[model samples]
Target chain A: MSTVEAYARRTARRGWWRDGLEAAIYLVAAVGVAFFVASGGLLATAPVDHLYGLGRVAGIVAAVLVLSQITLISRAPYVERVVGHDRAAAVHMRLGKVAFVLMLVHVGLILAMSARYDGRSILAETTALWQLGWFIPAAQAGLGLFAIVVATSLVAIRSRWRYERWHAVHLLVYAAIALVVPHQFLEGSTFRSGGAAWWFWLALWALAVGSFVAFRIVRPLWLLGRHDLRVAAVETHPDGSTSVTMRGRGLDRLGARPGQFLLWRFLDRERWTQAHPWSLSRAPRPDALRITVKPSGDASAAVRGLEVGTRVLVEGPLGVFSEVARTASGCVLVASGIGITPVRAMLDEAHPACTVVWRVRSRAEAPLLDEVEALAAERGARLVILEGPRGPGWGTAAGETLAGIVPDVAARDVYVCGPVAWADAVERDARAAGVPAGAIHRERFGW
Target chain B: MRGSRAVLVAGGCAAIVGAGWAASPKELPTLDLVAPSSPAASATPGATPSPTPTVSATAGATGASSTYDGPVVTNARGDYQARITVADGQVTDVQAVVAGTPDAQSVQINAVAIPALRDEVLAAQTWDVAAVSGASFTSPAFTESLRGAFEEAGL
Candidate 1:
């Protein structure tokens, strides 16, 4: 085998193994804290002190969970491959909520425990805790930032807030985590110098935060420096959307599969801080990558105005919506509107029995319809186009369904991308039609 | 992957709680090195003998080697125990061992303050030594721990 091909194969195998090891590491770190507490005589404590001990243990694990949230969302490549980028993000959000709740319980029970012993009211005890040191108040502020992140992320609230505003709050989680560190090292008894438990906690924090710095910070800077990526051309598609083709050297070595995405930061004087993740609208090429934007929001709308030589800083070619994720003999590519970008790209590598299902409100709304159709024909995949508004479901018409457009969709790996609700609808129908849950891949492009 | 994840999570949580029960301290634990001595332990009416004992008053040159376990004195900083060795009516040595963990700052603070405080007490040949400025609390706690040691030594 060629050296490059051999290295790719080995890397792929290691990625799968790392997923299981990641789980094992997470489990061990959390259990190690519990083990630390148990060794200190958890049950031998007065029945009343047991609550306090449990809270202390909860605090340790909650700290782990907080760090884990960062690790998962850092866009670490190995994790992205195992669960896919979208699922990693979804799990990141879910774990954030759980960690926050556990922390609240930890703080509440610890305060209550103190009150019981000090013979003071809970409120008075809380005041005492705040007075203990700068660490307690700092930790409280950290938890408060976490609350803001969780509050703004609520579905009802997130709809009203722009992605930039919500995301700005979301980024405070890093600061929240930093602010909480002193209390763990200074005040948390388990981390104090009695045993090796302190080292265990330190290692967990190092692994999680170190990965964040390496992948999110260092890797992006390296990619931007190495590739020297810039906009080679920006074309207004026949539809209202715009397509940006970026040029950089050695793009082929990026290992970006078709249907993957790049977190694109168009370094314009205006809105430079906003990064919109755009998927490849065409198969990844050797010296260039392309993304189609629909002008739907502030960031997307600004893409139409990007100068030809605009510098583009990218964090990925992330996500796993490709043929490598395929688990069936044939594949079904489903998309609506701009969602067709990934579907069009993936069609470049479609199998002989593959099928394409496109949903658009009208013919003009489909930007790359001609290219999609041509690709399908070349690969001998059936091309089914459905025009008109989506119905009660993700249907192209009032009563149309997946089985109607692609008769063998249930027998193939179905990749769906579009609006969040539309993609979810597709997944729901695919499952209802007896497709195994694992065979359906969808990316929810939401905050 | 999902099956494996489910198993890992369930087993992990079970292991945490199960190990928690297994590792907990036994009743009335031995506490070999030290325990965080409560304020109640020090404040009790007669737990400790009066500070003005005869051992410190006795004149020079006793040939016996004596070992004393000082009271585990806890302050805002944490707990500590000072082992005091006296020979020929001089305060031969004072070593303070912290009960729990001393954080980095405390470690540094105590590192400077403990030895100086010990020397001052040893030079004065008494427990009424002056406190160090940056380590006022530790100075007092160290003295208290030392006094507990002295009381055990009948001084």
Candidate 2:
């Protein structure tokens, strides 16, 4: 079979998995509301009762979205494989905003309805609710924590804080979820019945939280135990990037492909608290994995100072900017500045009809240039270097369209990894050159 | 694709509304403004039917009538008491009353639950009825009170 045919079949199958995952999210949310309806929520006649019903539905949807947010970021292999890590995290962020808003609506409507029903002021009803049971008060506390987490996550606030601080605040989401869960089962009329509705919620929570613990926490610890990875050597390049080579046993078992990144935590005193995402600068071998990090942040800068034999914990081989995402026989790999790490690693295993396009300000300052050039020559692949200041197009020269350079650009899959704006320009040019949207894969270099 | 997405959204909304409307009861039970029946006459159950009611006699002349108020049961929410009226060895009516610290939420819960509990008790003619939904405190209190009333009547 030809490469395009095989690629087509693989993508079609993967497309099903993506569709199924998306459909599951919608289905679970719908089922949540359905449970409320089954409990006769829609039968409410009074204005307060109607508001109470709305609160219940809002709470149910919010619960579903929250669970979904957990599942998306759980780093579950199946989810990452289907949607890619970047897409999953993007969805996670979007769902988080929606979930938080619905949560507020749920709390507000429930309070208003209770106040009206009891013929008391809202403040008085809140006090009464606090005295009602332990779980109600616990849920309120969780809501407060949620408010804090969300406030810190806002773009304006988040930009003001360091990544480590922002991340520590974000971890409170797990605690918030734990605190809020008890009231869902204990207080809701539908759930209290201990019937199908109860089981449905129980199973959903188990599935979501279970995946989170199993994949995000357990799998990494297990990998750490099995691999026993430690830094073997560190090389500082002329362009201010540091490449760390780590030696480990049976490293090939990680199933990491070229152009994939991992969240690396160097277990040193100074850098133990932060895990930075860095792509492998070379193809994985049985005994070693390497990462090239450009010093963009404090944690990244500390990579240059890492001592030999420093223990390491990793949470990937994540993302889909690899051969697994290809949809054509020929392929074009494009990179700019530090983005060349993944592209260089990918050249080692790319298709025979591959072309490497490196766009940089200067050849001497480009990281991993020599390695990519050597790999291109060894594999009989063409190389194109565009070095100069930014131009009107993706290329550094005027009228240098993708089609003008790589004549058969439309016949090849295009893989782009770089700064967001440069990558966007490359994608626009690739599309203008007649590349199908699905055939153009991008791995953006930031959170 | 945009057309399909719009259709999908519209269909989802319709399904949700349709399912909710279908699941709802034909008519919701409205809150009763009138006070419940006052305490019935308390009397021993007789093997032979006879008029033996002493206080507030409102029953038929033949059957002996007994009504007992269950001791107030306290839960986290508040206190609940069950009052049951028995005639001819059958519990004809049951009322769940919120006593102390009647939290407004509990009041709303009892309003909906009391009627459901009454139907359950009348249908079974016993104290053992399923707990009403959303009335965790009131259901058990009502059951405890009804059980005491039943034992006292010796039916």
DockQ of all models, two decimals each: 0.23, 0.23
What is the CAPRI rating of model 2's predicted complex?
A: incorrect
Give one digit per residue, the lDDT tens place, for model 2 in B1-155.
23564467557756865785677556544434223234332211111111222223356676767665555455445555566777877787776544323333344566787788889999999889999766777687668766766766675
DockQ of 2: 0.23
Candidate 1 off by > 4 Å: A1-22, A38-45, A130-132, A155-158, B1-155
In TM-score terms, candidate 2 sits at 0.85
**Cα TM-score per model:** 0.79, 0.85
lDDT of 2 by residue, A180-204 (tens): 9999998876688788889999999
lDDT of 1 by residue, A1-447 (tens): 664455456445645665564676467655766655554625333466667766876787788777777788878886777767887888777877888888899988887766665455888766666645788889989989888878878853546778887788788977888889989877775565546677777887898888889988798889888888899998998888988899998888878989989888878798568778889999988889998988887888778778888888888778878766766677788888889998888888877787788888998989787898889889898888888886778875576788877777788788998888788888899998878876788877874
Instruction: Point out the worst 10-residue segment of candidate 2 chain A by lDDT.
Output: A40-49
User: For each candidate, what is chain B's TM-score?
Assistant: 0.56, 0.60
Cα deviation in Å at residue B48, candidate 2?
41
Position A401, candidate 1: lDDT: 83
